[model samples]
Target: MSDTAPTSVVDQVLAAVSELLPEIAASAAERDRTRSLPRYVLDLLSSAGAFSVTVPTTHGGPGGGAAVAFEVTRLLATADPNVAQIPQSHFVYLRLAELAGSASLLDELFGAVLTGERVANAQSERTGRTVTDQTTRMRLVDGATVVDGRKFYCTGSLTADWIAVLGRDEDDVEQVGFVRAGTSGLTIVDDWTGMGQRTTASGTITFEGVRVDPSHVVPRQRAVTGPHGYGAFAQGLHAAIDVGIARGALTEAAAFVRSSTRPWFEADVERAEQDPLLVQRFGELEVDVRAAESALVVAGAAVDAIASAPPSRVDDVAREASLQVAAAKVLGDRAALAVTSALFELGSTRSSDDGLNLHRHWRNARTHTLHDPVRWKLQHLGRWSVAGTPPPRGPQF
Candidate 1:
């Protein structure tokens, strides 16, 4: 697998990011403080068609696949992880439109993202703590779906133009749907102040008889899989964020060590780069980031192959993709946690800046990794390996 950015365009995209980093990083704490992505920067990225990567070529998009998305995410996240993640959900749903749904739906979905519209996920809940407890109920009323539930961790709800929501069917099966902005009964609680990923605006959204048209609902029979199953797009998104977070941590650590003027113990080391320990840790983190990127590329290839091949071949490809995606998530999450924790150790004493809010890397990794640990995913893979049985088919996440 050629590990370089696949095309000149991709290389161009990567290069353009450097000039934007200073401004992007400058806004990181403020976005976290405000609990939202800076509007103007998002507009810049959207106008550049960053969100168009996974859309099919016929749709007038980049058609760059997961590898491109992965690189773009890491590059952007090197400045602001929260901002990088904000658009990830858009890409995942775009993948859905490309492979399994209608072109009209694609236009309705990705079009909004391309036009600088934001999105959020109203999946996680507050009280009914089970992984599958989607207390946010929806019912059909007067040609519209009525929603009534509270969603915890509703990222970007305050600024979202649309939200991809999951709810239960009449027979208790699950269905994924969308709720447009300004829908009646949709309310956001301004209460997402947190320890990390604050720019995510991950507040709670409550739906009380919110009305959505039948067109907003993804068809029942069209359900392929939820976010956390074999070949699940959600795992790909998770892996992207994990890699981005780790890469961002390493970048911050490198900058901090190169310029910190503070003293350490009996010696005023002056420069963090001068420390042998820092060098060793940086080398280790570099290897980890490269490994995660490679794993993601392999997973992307596997997904594309499965998506392109016969149905009989799909299961095998999906299983391979799932294992690799889970492995990537686990490795990336661990790498981010390890890298950030080591930075703090290298810093010795916490300084005022402390290198771009280094603690947020650890916090973001913890929150994302804990969402559905890659270890549990590994256990599922193990069951498939040991029993000669494919992992269960259907959306569990």
Candidate 2:
């Protein structure tokens, strides 16, 4: 879809998704109404090998790179934004396994991924004085690791098989530990009340002396500072989600204009599609979606390239990837908000329809894009343009 010839795995995955889209779309409204993702959809995705896309081929998986991930995310978001978003953190966990420097642990996690196990991220505590501050603690107890804290925005954990808890050790170093979902003393609260992306299940999780095996723990310092493509991978995934939302908005807008919308009485046009102003608006939205799509392709390719680069070139390649991804994120965020908001202007009263629930697009786009401030993204690009400075080492960069 982005002018690249997809590998066999990518092609097969896309074909499977195409076949499943009708069912996915048909249930999207109902799922949104309930503010929950259905198990059947996840089962279908597993059957299609969606979770195995990023697993290495040698690990008995597809090994689709970042570009394939972008395409898959875009397509899924077009069907259901919530469903599309469930894998964002899963991929991040997969990347973490690669960087964890524990071969046995990595192999175990990779095997779990191939077998359709989902990993949910438990980070972002509300009690923190600042975003970077963490009250979550990981400590040694009886020669075993234990994690204790309350985490909000624990996306996808409601149905996840494992939870990746981010915390700080006694030394104040950030660390991640994996725990089984039903582990004792661990509680996943379904209390997220966000106005958008309702089905993401981005709720709260409490870990009270939850045991974490030593092998399951990975220090996050290197992953945060090292020249891996994690940041770019994250940014690309978000950009693809926004792009998909914009595309979905545009698709719904065109359909409404063709069948349900009426032209302005004074315009002398028989149909809404025949109205020059409406046509101009559609054209503008199409251009925005196309621009966002192009940016995503560029950013995704940069991420894939940087991820495959040698260690000597990792820092430079990751820097370039960050710049590209920042640009793509800005464009995608803007396009999603613009397209979703503009959909209401195509006709009167349709925005108020309960059956359509069209407002979810804008809400989801607004909420998800706020994950990282776009102003900083622009500032990062500006600084790079003028000073040749790369983005700093951080997860959100």
Candidate 3:
């Protein structure tokens, strides 16, 4: 039940990422401008075996943990948040498959991942009463399991090799079905118009009686009674994205001020970097970014601890992990928003040029942080602080 991939493969992927990131970063602006899928980067990572790193050591993968994936995600986010966020549900599916405890499901899904196949999420629907609510149905038509419904915010669906959909079966039990990318009656639309993460292609997906191989439909999200990290792990990865956005924005801001920005006229400085006010602001922003970064790593470690906690202490450890992740997410959200907005302010009018696309950072952060409301994150933190209550368990925590 490890999303903690084998350690060795994880290390190799991380090492390769060090070389790929500069290339990834160099193309981000253009990709943002065109709203192009960061297919180049996605292919690069897949080729480097990033997706395969999470395959269980028992499956012949170099063993590692979710902490490694978080680090890799943080690095990817620094270069391109859209690409960084896309594969979230892919790994989440791996977690789900593990929870199902089905040997066949694990081999099929993990083998696909190892073969560089990508799974896009088709889980959310606008018509649902709540985010977790699912109305999509998987029905037995004569013999085939057919899916029929509409999904919104189907992130990564466009570029994905496979689609993982959450639906309900005849007994009103929730289930997840996997469909190949080009399955009949499936329609993927490129209609997302959000101000940020545009390349994510998180738009409309229509499944009209699309057939899923019966073997590909796993019983969804098995209930785990013990202290577990089912939700904390997902939230921690989110924090990693925010960390990347904050750091990336700050990095770009520094470069802009040093080479492209003008000095404040009142300061009579030759360069913006020499202006004491701008320097002070940059230092403060760096401190915020680094603090958020630290929180992200701590959150990852806390979540990792859950994987090994003995049965007696697992509950408390899991609760602590959730709390730590909530803190990391709060810091990440604040840093991403504050620093991204500050990037433009410090860089002046020139920074707003369309060609530079510096604004995409703020736009991406604003759009993404809105996806999972930050208010709930604070509410959990406050509940834990004042009432000595553990955060309620779920993806929201």
Best by TM-score: 2
lDDT of 1 by residue, 322-353 (tens): 66666777777777677767767665565336
Residues 1-397, candidate 2: write the lDDT tens digits: 5998756976898789878877887788778887766668977897788877888887777888888888888888888888888888888877777776477777888898888888889988887688778999999999879999999988889989989999999898899998889999999888988888898867799999999888889998778787877777877888889999999878987887788888888879898899898898889889999999999999989988876788888889989888998999999999999988898887557655877888888888998889788899999999999998888867886
lDDT of each: 0.67, 0.85, 0.84
In candidate 2 the C-alpha lDDT for residue 359 amounts to: 83
* Candidate 1 off by > 4 Å: 1-19, 33-37, 98-103, 226-231, 261-272, 350-356, 384-389, 394-397
Summing lDDT over every window of 10 consecutive residues in candidate 1, give the lowest-scoring window: 221-230
For model 3, how does the per-residue alpha-carbon lDDT over 219-243 read when each residue is reduced to its tens digit?
7656333466778877888888999
* Per-residue lDDT value at 148 in model 3: 93
Cα displacement (Å) at residue 329, model 1: 0.5
Candidate 2 global TM-score: 0.96
Stretches > 4 Å off in candidate 3? 1-7, 223-226
Whose TM-score is higher: candidate 1's or candidate 2's? 2
TM-score of each: 0.85, 0.96, 0.94
The deviation in Å at residue 384 for candidate 3 is: 1.1
After superposition, which runs of candidate 2 have C-alpha atoms over 4 Å from their true positions? 1-7, 310-312
Q: Which candidate number would show the highest lDDT if scored against the true structure?
A: 2
Pairs with backbone N, CA or C atoms under 3 Å apart (clashes), candidate 1: 226-395
